[model samples]
Target: MPIDPERARLLFQVISSCYERRSLILTTNIEFSKWGTILGDEKLAAATIDRIVHHGRLVEFGGESKRMGDSLMLGRQ
Candidate 1:
């Protein structure tokens, strides 16, 4: 889900506007810095990161990849 920084910033702006006028939710597959790396643009990435954090509630966690060769069946899902 790598995206250019400007695109990420625009997405953040759209989400912010949605939050202003309605409700919106987001889920990310990677951390913010990793997002910057994916974006490959420093200034826009920094701005996007700022917008994502400002006045935002964040909870961060990592999950093991079940698609790999893991022993657990994950409830046969």
Candidate 2:
């Protein structure tokens, strides 16, 4: 689902305010390219991403989801 416009604006404000002044750690399963659709604004998404990646370190993990391993229906088939 796309983010609400007002909330997206608020999020941008928060990120902008924190940019270069504070450290932030954001975790998302969504890819950077889809941020425009998620935020519902391409410009906002681009600005957000630009600030984040400018001083950010990306750490990617590979393997099955931990949630699936602990799911109740894992072996129900």
Q: Which has the greatest TM-score? A: 2
Whole-model lDDT values for every prediction? 0.67, 0.91
lDDT of 1 by residue, 1-77 (tens): 67765686677678657654665566877777776677777666676667567757787765776664454555444
lDDT score for residue 59 of model 2: 94
Candidate 2 TM-score versus the reference = 0.91
Give the Cα error of residue 12 in candidate 1, in Å. 4.5
Q: Return the TM-score for each candidate structure.
A: 0.56, 0.91
Superposed model 2: Cα runs more than 4 Å off: none
In terms of lDDT, model 2 sits at 0.91
Q: In model 1, how large is the Cα lDDT of residue 34?
A: 77
True-vs-predicted CA distance for residue 31, candidate 2, Å: 0.3
